[model samples]
Target: MTDKRTTAPALLCDVMIQIKQRLRPLESQEVLWDQAAGRVLAQAITAPVSLPSFPRAAMDGFAVRSSDLEAASPEQPCQLQVRGVAYPARPWPGTVSVGTAVRIMTGAAIPEGADTVAMLEDSEVSADGQFVSFRRPSPPGRHVIAVGEDVRAGQVVLPAGRVLRPQDVALLVALGLTSCPVVRQPRVMLLVSGSELVPPGVIPKVGEIVDSNTPLLQALIPRDGGQVVEVLRVPDDPVLLRQAFRQALTKDIDVVLVSGGSSTGDEDFCPCVLAEMGELVAQGLAIRPAAPTGFGWLNRAGTLLPVVLLPGNPVACLVAYELLAGRIIRHLAGRSLDLPHCQRTAPLRESWSSPPGRLEWVRVCIEQNQAVPLRQRGASSISSLVAADGFFLVPEEVTLYPAGTIVTVYLFDTLSGQQF
Candidate 1:
């Protein structure tokens, strides 16, 4: 028999911990290094060979032995014969014996006997290219980079579980890696339920609303490393919703996101359907504007698959996704448990009030070091989310705050136009 539940709201922090403990990471896969950006590293990466591999010049200067010019003065320039010119990545092919110097460019290998380099401004090359004079003396090892200076072979470069950034991919390529091992992206199946909902690009008739949740979840799921494999729309009928859940259980899906129909109203069938198919882990959360958020698990072929029921309101759905569904998606992608966001601290432009029972998240915009609260037209307002730069959380312990209150704003635009 499936375990069913309808109980008191769960504390925000406890539910976060529970979600972390319940999920397991997916298997790793091999992908090309160029395609590994935004993916989690499955194994620690080590340098295959030391960078530079040999000693080279770091500046466009004449290679010389320091002792030859130690006693030489600017007025009495140290005169030396220029044996040969060394271009980048090429050596002079001969040693700089006493009173001799090699004209070298940046990144050129040092001659066998040269121990230092003098800048071009300090040396005057003769028109014949056979002689050069130094006005300044250079110490040994100046402007010279030794072998293994940047990275050493067999040394760990990046640890496992690191989210690959653009620079990380460049580093891996520089280390001669053509491919990388990363955790597989989780596949999601989205099911939207509502009798009044219509797809985008279609004008809704009277008493009907455009289906925003489907497109919203489609854009967000992949940003967090989960790919939406399918999207299906179902009416408010329990029979159709039950059939959708049964069909989803038979397919290969990492998680099922059921949007709408999670409330206690008569049309809400997500909780009842989840209870019949599997175990309802929790019914609600003690959070403002998102109290209808819930999650559960369904068993198929002896494997437990997670099912997340989301509220219909766009803003509430966004909050529920970030705090709950996003966590599981990141875990399945082998990412770190910490939720990442670009944070900015600012003072409130006006006073704000909240209830004491549930945690609250307020959308706000930053203007000249102040967080101006956006006008909330209920949780269904998509314009408010777009106009706001980020949001601030209000704990259940605090109810009111005066103007100029400093708060940290968690930015949602960190990964805009880029894969996370």
Candidate 2:
């Protein structure tokens, strides 16, 4: 009978500040370097040994003294005795003398007394394998990788808080690291509360819809470096919702996400339950499509678990998750707090308008390097997101963006399908 919506909605910036102030990264754990990709580094990794610790050939070449080829030319080719051959794992035991050369493969240790490597293409070896002839002068250090050419011992190769990529894993392996210290992934519990919702496999009857939020969150949680430990579908009843909240807190959860029941409707009980169980820090964000978004802290044992109350609408739920829940999860996983989107400044293909006081996320398709605003702007339009390549935010103060206005579009697919 009473409207409980806050007349003055909290700014998105304020809510984000509160969330960051209360949460911290999870404890670090040691995992094998082979399994460290996509995990955030918990500590700085210093190189124990220099990469290419020994002087090695950078290409398949003949290791020879630079002075021997100093006067070699097309008209007066230089001839040198072939001392031995060197492979990557097998180095030539003998040294390169003034008139001799060692046939060396890439990555093979450079034979002693050799200051340059004449590429195999530039040298001709005799059929008898006794002598090699070069027509071009070779410079010192040419085609040779000196000791510590790539990484130096005791140098910080990977810094703390960095998400390990495939290349990063390779570097760690090159550094001779068997295991790496990475922040543990944040554990999450998803609670989808609605009476008219059915599981994904079930065919929804009249007035009932398939619960898409669960699957959406399931996919997104891991993308933001979170592990969903439990998922529960709660009815609209406040009692059951409250029980679900209690049960989620009992588990080892870093964050609890409640999709639906966040608005100020009669069945909307998430805000009340949060207030009763812990402290409701934010409610009714000043953001379009996700205005009912709420944030709170639940005291479980001695820890304060973050609880995000997202609107039931599929699009609204997604927006809230991207702006709030995703940030929380990434922070707890020791990753950057920035949104996992590659942003690019592009001009709008058409004019767009938003409410003067609410931040709006406008789904747009990139066409001809321009952001084309979609027609489906409803909070429940999942199709809009499906068709969108990215979205752009309109500031709370601005109401309209004229056609061709430059705006930053956050791309959904970039940097391995996420943030840059």
Question: Which 10-residue window of candidate 2 scores lowest in summed lDDT?
Answer: 411-420
lDDT of 1: 0.86
What is candidate 1's lDDT per residue for 1-420, written digit by digit as tens? Answer: 122445888877887676677778999999998799999899999999988777789999988999998876789999999888898756778889999998889999988899998889888888988888888789999999988898999999989998899999998998899999999999999999999999998999999999998899999888888899999899998899989999998888899998998878878888988988898877888887788988889988887788888999999998888878888888888876555677778889999898887888889888877888886937888999998888898898999877999988888888555221
The C-alpha lDDT values of all candidates are 0.86, 0.90
Q: What is the lDDT, from 0 to 100, of the residue 216 in candidate 2?
A: 95
Specify the poorest-scoring 10-residue window by lDDT in model 1: 1-10
lDDT of 2 by residue, 1-420 (tens): 233656577898998787778777899999998789999999999999998889999899899999999999878889999988999999999878889999999999999999999988788889999999999989999999988889999999999989999999999998888899999999899998999999999999999989999999999999989999988999998789878988987898889999898988888988888888898888888898899999888898878989999999999999999988899999899888887888899999899989988999889988888889998889998888988988999999999999999999988886644322
Question: TM-score for each prediction?
Answer: 0.91, 0.93
> Can you give the lDDT of residue 213 in candidate 2?
93
Q: After superposition, how far is residue 117 of candidate 2 from its true place, in Å?
A: 1.8
TM-score, structure 2 vs. true: 0.93
CA shift of 27, model 1, Å: 2.6
Against the true structure, candidate 2 has what lDDT?
0.90
